[model samples]
Target: AQSVTQLDSHVSVSEGTPVLLRCNYSSSYSPSLFWYVQHPNKGLQLLLKYTSAATLVKGINGFEAEFKKSETSFHLTKPSAHMSDAAEYFCVVRGTSGGYQKVTFGTGTKLQVIP
Candidate 1:
């Protein structure tokens, strides 16, 4: 069975502070991991992806994640959080067996920004 657990359901930070959203995954095979950010009523934007490539992957908006096979973790991090960064984030894993790529999203982590 494949599953993912987000360490936090909600994260609140003031503008300019560091941000960390933790995630751990379990898979039967080599998994493709992704992090997506969605603004209210907007579509998901891919932040980063890990597909047997570099262990440390950087994405847009100064966000990055390190794929740790041993730890079975792919935690998203940013040096600083912006006010615009307030949104919902979902950790996703692509399914292997299905013909169409089925992306399973984590429950979600809502980011709250304080002025």
Candidate 2:
């Protein structure tokens, strides 16, 4: 079984500042992890993913994350926050459930950008 936990339910950042969203996860074996972002009244967008190939993965909109096996953590970060970055983010984990693969999403982190 695999699961993901988002450490923060909400994150507020000033425009032009840095952004950070924390997450941790567990899996029975090597798993596929992903981060997805959603704007208000919009569809989910893929941010980044780690499939056990590279540790540091880059994504769109100047966001990136590192997959640390020892820490069981996958944290998302952006050097500078943009006003458009305000949204809700989900940390997802892919694992096996019974005989089928399952994808689990965290509670989500709502990012509020303060002008």
Report clash pairs, candidate 2: none
Estimated TM-score for each candidate? 0.92, 0.97
Candidate 2 per-residue lDDT, tens place, 47-72, comes to: 99996779999999999999999999
Instruction: Report the lDDT tens digits of candidate 1 across residue range 1-115.
Output: 6788888999999888999998998877788999999999999999999978699999999999999999999999998899999999999887665545556788889999888
Instruction: Single out the weakest 10-residue window by summed lDDT for candidate 1.
Output: 94-103
Listed per candidate, the RMSD to the true structure in angstroms reads: 1.5, 0.8
Top candidate on lDDT is 2
TM-score of candidate 2 against the unseen true structure: 0.97
